[model samples]
Target chain A: MRAVGAEEVAPTSHPWEIQADGLVVRVGGRRGRNAVNELTLRLGRGVHGLLGPNGAGKTTLIRTLATVQKPSAGSLSLLGTPLGRATGLRPLRRRLGYLPQHFGYYKRFTVREFVEYLAWLKEMPPEAIPGAVQRALEKVGLADRADDRLKTLSGGMVRRAGIAQAIVNDPEVLLLDEPTVGLDPAQRLSFRELVAELGQQACVLISTHLVEDVAAACTDVVLVSEGSLVFQGTPAELAAAGTTDHVGDSPIERGYTALLSAGPGRSGW
Target chain B: MTAHHPGEQLLRQYVRGDDVPADQLWAVEAHLESCAPCRGRLAPDPIAEQVWADLAPVLDRTPQMPPARSWLRHVSHWVSPVAGPWLAMILLVTAVAVALDQAGSVARGQISLVLLVAPVLPVLGVAASWGRAMDPAHELTAATPRAGLPLVFRRTVAVLAVVVPGLLVASQLTGASLTQWMLPCLAFTTCTLALGGLIGITRAAITLIAGWAAGIVLPTIALSRTSVALDVAATPVWAAVLAAGLIVIAVRFRTQSRSS
Candidate 1:
């Protein structure tokens, strides 16, 4: 639950890595309802936690950030490059690392091979791959199991492998959706440490339902409901929104319930 | 210990952005990890500073052997493990068709079952090579920067690599001219990809397979003769189809990949 002030981190010369302005993403069909509705956010270098209930457009927003899906309306930019332009997004994609909520893997690939393949996809220099793969595996504590095939590993280890692939390229923008789903408590602690370390340079956005995770790791928390952002601020600010009547085991959870009940239209810090 | 470390000059060269050899750079990095004083001694240039910032976290670790040998690595990129059984099945089907032709049971007049089935073999292989339903890693693969045409083409080449040689051998055994099936085979494969960019590969392959079976294979069997499309005289037409398919695939690839 430690928060690093933006002033403590070196200011980035590049524009916000993720800037979404009045972004609207509709799913189903042409007249489909909004999956992400008029959401706007600007993020730089830090760890951000996105919290919401099921069907709150967290995954939709993450997919859009990953550039896997186009917004039905509004504008988005990654690394200062505007999306939906005639110019290709490869340059921005090359700098992105994404782990989807339902991460898929080639079961036959060894952990090392999986990470290396992702690095290649990211267009890392060929010579730098071996070293980068090794470092990424080490960061995720999967170095010992680097040679093990993905199918042979436990679920938690596989999740760790997903994280390893995400970081293999040392991405400038990292989007991880529900990264701690299968991890044990100890692994979650280590994952938090790793996220803290990555936040020093990269803009890290993690989408999860675990309020404790948001409380413990996030420098800032964004709360969204019904496809729109309701709150954004430091974890303490979120906790302050909690009322004595709110039901939760902890301050962050109380804060979560408080804001979620209060719903959208609350001003962000 | 000597005051001047052996890596000092190399580290200086590294900082100056001189072309330091990989091993020398590695050595200097390894030495600097434990040698804080030497690290401080190296004055920072912006380029070198950024390089170090990026590399310092990742380079000090012990290097592991690359996950696969170069050839295996290339093969893995081209096809998945599930592709092994699928390729084997394609070969087996070709062998069965060759056997039936040799036995004279499935042969209708001059038409061989092998010839009838040859054009779609690579299509089946290409279908198996990619698809959201077929590939367990499709989601992860799709999210990658290189996931579109390049990947699709790589898998297609891999399929052709296996299916083409098998069909060539089958054709030799059946005494069928290579042009009778090769051109159409190439055409069908390209068309699968060309259509795949729009409708998806599995659907394209299935549609092509169903169309060929109904339009050519069934009619040729019913008439006890080869279809005109598979005739040696149709080589030029097949060639034209192949060319068009390639053009479509190229255009579609450029548009789809650019949009993605």
Candidate 2:
């Protein structure tokens, strides 16, 4: 596949593509303990891999970005629109695509129907949907299987269908939580290429435990643990933080281990 | 290259981020993917560049032939996968009630079972329409822009579409006054949605069904007398309850969207 040239243009009209200031998300109740506590980050157009151990609040952060969960305290703004206001949410949602960790599907729905339904939900122009759905399914390598019922698909195919729906709108911001969980090696490679293509213009945040995926596809990395940001930098930068004593086969994996052990206060980025 | 290139007017409109017709845009994009000269002719506007950036990769590949069109594709938005079975079940229940009434079960002045059960059937359908536990795609559906009360209402409408007609037919056959059953039926459905905003839809349906059975159905059966709740004289009360339930649902929708 050909690589599309990156655009060089004027500064964006929006001040920040995605801005989070002292974002605190509580899991259970108003007084419930924090799931994501006092986490602050700013992201612009690129592929960002969100990494952490299990129960590290990665999913919480992804959910908050996806607007599936409201922030209990602090603020979040996407594409220059504040999430707190109800009026701005629909428009923001129009440009947002999210694939949750436990992605759900209507088992009886064919692949084409599933993606088309999501395109409608994202408020795509009805006329533009057919072409867009065609493009999205092709991009995810599911065009041939578009008519197959979701229940008939294998686990990896279902994940690809999830991706097809996410990209059908040509979303400005895409949040994918554990999107690669079911894919084999070849599919993972194609996914990396897809991410690279999407990242050229959109802000793509992927929450996963795979350091290799982050190393291969992500332009930037954010490490979170216990609902707090531990590190933020390029894969090379993360790899540089690793020491000989750290565990894992790859530098990115070692860096991840090293950083988590170094804990909250010692983020090098 | 052919001299028959797209006009400057078209290029300008495309660059200005105007809503170019979809076919025109598709043709232009397909051409631009190969013709770097034409791509260069386009202005350096960031938004246009971004649109092209997103479109170029898609234009390069050959999409597989779309499958044969299915009827489910058209109506799947409002009606869920489980709706057909639920509707069939409702019809079956209605048929059984009609048969029982035809056999003179109500000759002794007892209320018909169909009349007793009709009020909550749609409520059960609405409950089955959408829920976290019921839909396999619930989380994915919830994340979409169209998720929430609007989607819920659409599914409810689908449920009612199946249910109301069946009940109307049953009422005609069993000689039950349409007002006597329709009012309570609508009231129960709206109330289930209203209460569903607090508890879940499934729970709300169960609670309302149980309440209706205990408070009205069981007593009517035991006493072998018509229940005041289903009488035509109680139409005003049922209408009032329906209105209140609608109000509650509207308010709850606002709160739910805001919180989410």
Best candidate according to DockQ = 1
Which runs of model 1 end up more than 4 angstroms from their true locations? A1-14, A29-32, A265-269, B1-71, B107-110, B253-260
Per-residue accuracy of model 1 over B65-160 as CA lDDT, tens digit each: 554556656777677645888999999999999898888886443678888888889999988888877777676777677777887888888889
- Assign candidate 1 its CAPRI class: acceptable
What global local distance difference test value does model 2 have?
0.85
What is residue B236's positional error in candidate 1, in angstroms?
2.5
lDDT of each: 0.85, 0.85
Error of 2 at B43 (Å): 20
Model 1 residue A136 CA deviation in Å? 0.8
Where does model 2 sit among the CAPRI classes? acceptable
With a 3 Å backbone cut-off (N, CA, C), the pairs that clash in candidate 2 are A104-B137, A105-B137
Instruction: Write down the TM-score of model 1's second chain.
Output: 0.73
How many residue pairs clash in model 1? 0
lDDT of 2 at A59: 88
Q: lDDT score, residue A202, model 2?
A: 93
